[model samples]
Target: MTETVTLTVRGMSCGHCVRAVTEAIRAEDPAAEVAVDLAAGTVRAATALPRARVAALVAEEGYAVQD
Candidate 1:
């Protein structure tokens, strides 16, 4: 079953940040669906990967993921 993970990411100020975050998540699950809310600083992703893994990928992009 697919799981949906929503993470609060810090330091995302523009569209580039969104793309970066999306790419980071896709790095782990290429078929995952990622949605970015710049104003809310949240990244909602649908994937089978563990939440911890998703958070780690977001952090890899120099973004803080609020668990």
Candidate 2:
């Protein structure tokens, strides 16, 4: 089953940041659904991958994921 996780991310200021985060998640799971709320600094993704892995991928994109 797929799981939906919402992550609090910091330092996302524009469309580029949104795309970067979305790409980072999609890179891990091509079929994953990614939603970015730049104003709220949150990223919601529906994926089968574990949260830890998702967090890592987002971090790899140079953004800080709130714990």
Candidate 3:
């Protein structure tokens, strides 16, 4: 089953950041739907991956992701 992961992310202040995070998550799940709210510093994704794994993917992109 697919699950939506909503995480509080920090240090994403531009379009580049958004793309980077989105790409990172999508890399893990090609069909994942990713939405980044720069103003709110949050990322929401529709994916089958576990929440911790999703957070780790964002972290791998050098962004701070809250658990």
lDDT of 3 by residue, 1-67 (tens): 7899999998899999999999988888999999999999999999999999999988998889876
The local lDDT score (0 to 100) that residue 27 gets in candidate 2 is: 82
TM-score to true structure, per model? 0.93, 0.95, 0.94
Residues 1-67, candidate 2: write the lDDT tens digits: 6999999999999999989989988887999999999999999999998999989988998999999
Scored by Cα lDDT, where does model 1 land? 0.91
Model 1 RMSD in angstroms: 0.8
Candidate 3 TM-score, true structure as reference? 0.94
**Models sorted by TM-score, best on top:** 2, 3, 1
lDDT by residue (1-67, candidate 1, tens digit) is: 6899999989999989999989988887899999999999899999988999999988989999886
How much is 2 displaced in model 3, in angstroms? Answer: 0.5
RMSD of each: 0.8, 0.7, 0.8
- Which portions of model 3 show Cα errors greater than 4 Å? none
Compared with the true structure, model 2 gives a TM-score of 0.95
Model 3, position 45: C-alpha lDDT score: 96
